[model samples]
Target: MEKRLLDYLQKILNARVYDVAIESRLDPATKLSQRLGNQIWLKREDTQPVHSFKLRGAYNKMVRLSPDELARGVVCASAGNHAQGVALSARRLGCQAVIVMPVTTPTLKSDAVRSLGGQVILHGDSYSDAYAHALELEKKHGYIFVHPFDDPDVIAGQGTVGMEILRQHQHPLHAVFVAIGGGGLISGVAAYIKAVRPEIKVIGVQMTDSRAMLNSVTAGELISLPDVGLFSDGTAVKKVGQETYRLTRELVDDFVTVDTDAVCAAIKDAFEDTRSILEPAGAMGIAGLKQYIAQHNLRGESLVAITCGANMNFDRLRFVAERAEAGEEREALLAVTIPEERGSFRRLCETIGPRNVTEFNYRISHERTAHVLVGISINNRGEVPEIRRSLATQGFSALDLVDDELAKEHLRYMVGGRSQLNANEQLYRFEFPERPGALMRFLSGMHPDWNISLFHYRNQGADYGRILVGIQVPPADLATFRTFIDSLDYRYVDETQNPVYHLFLC
Candidate 1:
């Protein structure tokens, strides 16, 4: 082990990566430090030319190729950052580059490779399929295959990140957090860190659903997962590289498995400090770091997390934002039951006073009681039980839905439909400037004589709050109800006559 570590140390010292990669900044996260009571530093590998640390390994491996091999060019299979790295490296070396990506890969990623002068081939629906096709091409066309994580040269190139970190921060560091996928980055980082500063712990971070490395280490052998989750697609590897598995097991001090929600929260944390978004796998290190600090109850010690990549799909930001609060225990989802009486709904609202409601979905389900799916903004996890107790005191039964996957993804939106108690009900859509008390104020201002039959509201991170509401009003009072709505000055559209409403909600 000592000999192997020294060999990698020398290789990293001599690695040629400056041709395409940058020495990314190691910026301090001041806000996080203040909140967590730990001095946190981010190794900004996302600042690489391809917005990923993959370039360091790709360029390091390619620069040493023999003249004839360089002439033959190279090929690689990657669904994300690694593809961009090899493409950009081949461009700098004036070599032909062919990138094989799964057909399911987003066009944004494929187009990025093309923009870097790499030929793209969209193959089957998954990385395994694309990888098989790339191997076939390598044998058929005599192209050098640039393995993403397995090769010695590639690992050495990635180790340069560790070398740079040590040189940049000679101060006392308690631990270094690294995100692990097929394990190249962490293996390389662990190798260098352990060799040079053995006392400083090297920690590996992996998503709970795709923890091949962690499982392999635990089993004392390589293990292949039957499947992996796609939330952190970059790190969703079924099997880790053999070389990487060995190095990680020997050099890494510990491993932490984080869930998708925690990764989403970590992404939000990075954005807060740097005003930049991170891909799920890229933010895994930060998630692990926070977990470590909490579990160990450590404070005031310096720690580092590698911000590895930032090639995020724009559409995923909404899902991340929706789950981030839950990950940090800052939001609570509940199913509350209240008596189906005239004043019970109002009482429930009064009990929940002051706290912002992130979401609310309700329909008159039974003649005796009504069930509500509501989301409330919270300060921490401890607030959940307190809120439940408060609801109980008001004669409402509350079920915590914060960790319920079905409740969060599907049931929340499926809470309303046609009801037998909807007699004389009229539907309306209203848009008002969004603020903390918007929903509560609307409910309080409603006429006491009117009964609410259906209600749906979700915070979309938009400037305006849009809600769909159904109110039961007597036919004789239709004119007065219209006048009342007009007086509120909120933008409103009557959905009572909409064909879709009749089909789905009436």
Candidate 2:
């Protein structure tokens, strides 16, 4: 079956598929190769017109359709790469294409599909929901449903990537790391590679939060997940495809799952190495490669990592940029509670040495205590343990939230909550110097009865830093609160009428 598929792929490659330029000869960086102790090669699938290997499979599937089926058109469900591929391929084949996508999918992807001449139907809240809707449409309209990574023809189409890699390389390939979602790409590549070179290792990578293929392979049966973390939306599959899982179980040599942080770090690495911004799924192969090399201590072996796609949302880049530093162990975040006293804030700053402070967020909710969240740069991964130990010694209970999902996803965004809300709340925007003792001076003059309701501060490169402070005062104490603000000797704006603070903080 594998040989037959390979033969069919060879014919398809020669007859139907475009001779996409092979980019295999590009040499790996000396620094990276030396660090990994392997001859690393990147398969630049992102260099393709559709910015992914999905086009190969889509084109192959469309070309083989009968005249009647072509008249009926082709339909599939996808959020990103597959949508673009199917749209472009159907247009090239002179057939109508319909793409069904989740409503949560970004507009950038939907626009690309439409631009490629595919009729896009936005429905449902998740990929599974969109897929079910697409199946219904297929049954109603008699349109061919092109499975993303499940069908045998699709697998054969993706197998062409492996064939190209082998043909492009002069040296023997020891291992190839490929990202797995529904597992079609890995299944095809593994089948072809194992057939031609049984000794070559085929490793599959999936995000730890969406590890359907890894879970299925481990259990020796197909397993479904109730929900998948969608950081890498391209590979967020609740269940591996039936055909792809079968092929993977028989052909894949090893499997690994990477956390979202690791995938983000790999994205930064790929950008630095190749000057290309790969989507989270595209970077998974590289993340898996790093883990594999570390686990087996495999040095001086030739390894290839397939950069699968680059269809990333521009808005997501902000989140990626924020987490990339901590993901790479170049930054650390600490949540610490300290006494709400004059000199205590300064003492906390004294504990942090020359390491540049990336972020500082503090709230004076309690009369006697203040909670401050601080982000600091780290030299390397080894510094984390030492930093934790130092904070412990300083009588500060510190929570290391460098890789904590709750902290990264929710806590950071909604840190200030209703816990601090009280009657007569006044929000003030104050600008202060960036030097030490600034916070101490601000807190020293505060009235003992008045309480801080909310506090938010993020350092932007500015001459004077701005902070939002919410203070609660009794109705009778309005005059006293005004006097307190006047005594602080800082310009303040009353945000009591701001709708955002009233709705969220109140």
Candidate 3:
């Protein structure tokens, strides 16, 4: 190991955090192990007092502070997990703490931080926004800024988790899967593990849409994401820290990205194996582990995943449940067009055979053929193509809607609402910001000249708020409407000409 790397390894070895954090257990996922044909171990950091590994870094860094810095107190910004860590650390250290969080943060997380004796300030819409607000507070109040994952001390503190994992498990570790946000946890873990067990791989996991670190490492330079998905809010960092980026690129063996559905499925996997629920960010490692295992087709080797946090919002479970089956490729959603003539329904069922039907929705159309949405249970993703081919063989056209975000988020719910009364009504799909009053801001942004005929939205705990809107614009105002949309500055798609809209929602 290089001199600087060895120095960090020593810091991780000597970090003091037991005053608050505990040595989380290395529990084996026996059921998952049997299913995957490999030993899968979970580093139970969710069992931390704050229900996250963040406390380790928070307390470790705070304890090392000088008397003057301790007296000055601390402030930091986080989506949720690190806020709780800072809060709990401050409560223990007998110093005041101020946690700045995005207004889009989950209520459960914000409440937890408040209960831990930290003053919670609900600030901007994004972590970058909150960080900016936090910096101002730091300067104004003479508070020490507590970086969530940037500082060497924080990274070293998190490295203790690697130490515990190695000491607890004598079995050869093929890889240690970790979720990366600002890269502190993985950086610390990777540094220690590489110094001590160089042969073992340190893999980093990230949500596909929120993978700033992944993109940066791939580019071989730090990259800033203009926006990030919020399903895994704790790990939705726009940019990784400088030191963390350097360490991660050097120490991490590979990077893997999983989508929202995969994380949802991983959450279900954890619950099934250990009867414990993990948040989306916590489940990221498991999702990446499953993806990696399938990609390499490896078996009989031991692998470890950090089941890092469990501060899940109760309401989010419904969305997680809905997507888990699809994520695991146990379910496939299809849109089928069938003739309105007699025996069409029976023939469709016959074609579907005895496959478990999870969802079936049908609406009569004015056309000769009708569109119906159906979800079928399957053994794996490969079955989707087979089913599509089977439907084609039966003279029915089937469109696989499993990977279609627009279909899953909106079309599935609004397929029955076909309209023809409003002339020149334009259909649009929008990605609104997730912060409070976002809808109001969108509504307010529109000109009164363009009347909103219809609007539908459901929060999925994601960074971008998905909303579908229908507005009436006179043909004469088409150019004005185009200009208005451009001024809105939100990601949007004109769905006015979409066949699905024509079939059911025009």
Worst window of 10 by summed lDDT in candidate 3: 497-506
Better of 1 and 2 by lDDT: 1
Native-to-model Cα distance after best TM-score fit, residue 172 in candidate 2, in Å = 3.5
- How does candidate 3 score on lDDT? 0.90
Worst 10 residues of 1 by lDDT: 457-466
List TM-score per model, in order.
0.82, 0.78, 0.96
Q: How does each model score on lDDT?
A: 0.86, 0.77, 0.90
lDDT at position 256, candidate 1: 89
Runs in model 3 deviating more than 4 A are 433-436, 459-464, 475-479
Residue pairs with backbone overlap in model 1: none
In candidate 1, position 15 carries an lDDT of 95
Name the better of 2 and 3 by TM-score: 3
Which ranking of candidates, highest lDDT first?
3, 1, 2
Task: Give per-residue lDDT, candidate 1, residue 193.
Answer: 91
Model 2 regions more than 4 Å off: 1-15, 19-31, 34-37, 339-343, 365-369, 410-506
Error of 1 at 486 (Å): 54
**lDDT tens readout by residue for model 2, 1-506:** 46654664564345345633233333374555776778888888877787888887777777889989999999999867888889888888789999998765666778989999999998865578789999999999999999888887787778878887788775887889999988878977887787777788999998887898889888989999876766777887888898898889988899888887778888887887888888888899989998898889898899989998888777677767877786677888777777778888887888887879888877666678667778889977788778777777877767777765435543456555755336777877776544557788888878888888777776533223457787888788888788877776554567677533442355
